[model samples]
Target: MAATTALDTLIDLTKEALDQAARLLAGERRTQQQVLQQLQTLNQYRLEYGQRLQEALQQGIDPASLLNYRAFLGSLDNAIERASQTLRQQQQKVDNSQRLWQEQHRKLNSYDTLVERRQQTVMLHASRAEQRASDELSARMSRNGAALLPPSDQSA
Candidate 1:
């Protein structure tokens, strides 16, 4: 019973650890999703900007204006690249967090299983001990009852 109590304490600790890990993983996943959304928004803006530049070229824009448009487009491309890289890094973090949480969850489950098996074993031993005690009491009662019986009249 003492061991079972200790195991229960350990299981509670393990569950708390697992919950913490899961929360961390969830936060990482949320951050990764936000980064992905930012990346997509950047790409869409870049595409629109490129289309505008093409239209201006078709309308015979001035050289100075053309140079400015191209420079801005180049910066947009760089920004888009940076966002893509950030998204990738964020994804890696999410993946790592997920793995950590899974490990913690597995460990917690193993501890729970151990506690359940141990409890079952303790119950089985208790049951066997009770049976043995009952058997001994019955044997003692039978002997006492036999001694208390009246003697038979076989000499008559």
Candidate 2:
């Protein structure tokens, strides 16, 4: 019984840990998604700017204006690269969190199994003991009943 109580406590703690891990994983995933969205937006903006530059070149734009457009595109490219890197790092964090959650879940399952086995053992012992007591009572009743009966006569 003490063991069962201890296991129950451990199971509760493991469940809490598992829940916390799940929350962390969820947060990490959300951050990763946000990073991905930002990266996509950056890519789209860069594409649009590049198209504008192309149009300007086709329409005979001034050299200074062309340089400015090219410089801006370069900066946009850099930003996109950084965003991509951040997304990768965030994905790693999400993966780590998922693993942590899995481990905690496994621990909880182990504790539950232990508790179940302990209960089964206790129940089996109780059942055996009851059976023994019932058998003893039945044997005692039979012996007492035989002694109470009168002896049969030999001659008819």
TM-scores, each model vs. reference = 0.83, 0.91
- Model 1: lowest-lDDT 10 consecutive positions: 1-10
Off by over 4 Å in 2: 154-156
RMSD of every candidate to native, in Å, equals 2.6, 1.5
How high a TM-score does candidate 1 get? 0.83
| Candidate closest to the true structure, highest TM-score | 2
Give a tens-digit lDDT track for model 1, residues 61-147: 999999998999899899889988988898898888888888888888898889788879889999999999999999999999999
Identify the candidate with maximal lDDT.
Answer: 2
Residue 128, candidate 1: Cα error in Å is 1.0
Candidate 2 lDDT, tens digit per residue, 110-148?
A: 887887888898999999999999999999999999999
Give the range of the ten consecutive residues with the poorest summed lDDT in model 2: 1-10
